[model samples]
Target: MTQALTLARPYARAAFALSREGGRTAAWSQALAFASRVAADPQAQALLGHPLLNPADAVGLLAPDGADEAFTRFLGLLADNRRLVLLPEITGQFEELRAEAERVVKAKVTAASELPSAELDAIKAALKKRFGREVEIETAVDASLIGGAVIDAGDVVIDGSLKGKLERLQSTLSQ
Candidate 1:
């Protein structure tokens, strides 16, 4: 997985750069996401590395209807290089780049129970302040958390759950 991500990074950056230059960042993002979904299907996965697969056919399979010429060419390049299997990783990195450029951060919060909208709003506000960017939050309920909540904003994770606190306390006493 790490090797695939390392290999996909350059291609992702190249795609991002081209999309930004062409002023088609959003379109490219949607197209890449579509391609990624297509490549993720089990049937498509089986054919990605098949010796008899044609590059054009690979691009045809991955490219969405009415895909722009440049985007299709990019898919063609990946197909020719036998790197089409990396589409999912490449799409992920591309979205990260797009999000960074747009100054948006995505966060996930898990709590022992469903969070109230007011609490979720507060968390979003705090994260926006911390990252100095607009924040989009997705929430979930995990009963194992016992109490409190966990906020995961990519590089930052704040684990304030009762379960987490008990584990930490146990570790400290053991040490």
Candidate 2:
């Protein structure tokens, strides 16, 4: 995982720079995401590794017709280098750069049960206030949490779940 990230860093930075210069961060984000998804597909993965496939054909497999010339060129470069498998990591890094530029943060919240819309909104509002940036929340239900929620917001993790509390209590009692 670390190696893939290391390999992806330069490409991601280059793509981010291009997007920033062109004032098309959102567009590049979508294109990278789409390409990543395509590259992850089993059939597409096989095609990407096919010895007979040319770089142009590989780019066409991932990119839509009439894509921006810059994006096509980027895809072609990846294809030429046989780095199509790094698309997902590149997309992730690109999103991180985009979020930093836009003053936004992505957070994951896992709860024992589905949170009410109002509750979720309140959580998001609080996160935005705490982080001093727009927070985009992704929620998941984890029955193992037993109760409450655990929030993973960038470098900050708030383990508020019942399971987490129990574990902490156990450790304290042991000590």
Score candidate 1 by lDDT: 0.95
* lDDT, each prediction: 0.95, 0.94
- Please write out the lDDT profile of model 2 over residues 1-175, one tens digit for every residue: 9999999999999999998888888889999999999999999899899989999989988996556889999999999999999999999999999999999989999999999999999999999999999999999999999999999999999999999999999999999
Clash count of each predicted structure: 0, 0
On TM-score, the candidate that comes out on top is 2
Model 2 segments more than 4 A misplaced: none
Candidate 1, residue 46: lDDT: 96
- TM-scores across all candidates? 0.94, 0.96
lDDT by residue (62-126, candidate 1, tens digit) is 99998899999999999999999999999999999999999999999999999999999999999
Weakest lDDT window of 10 consecutive positions for candidate 2: 60-69
Q: Candidate 2: which pairs clash?
A: none
Candidate 1's displacement at residue 35, Å, is: 1.0
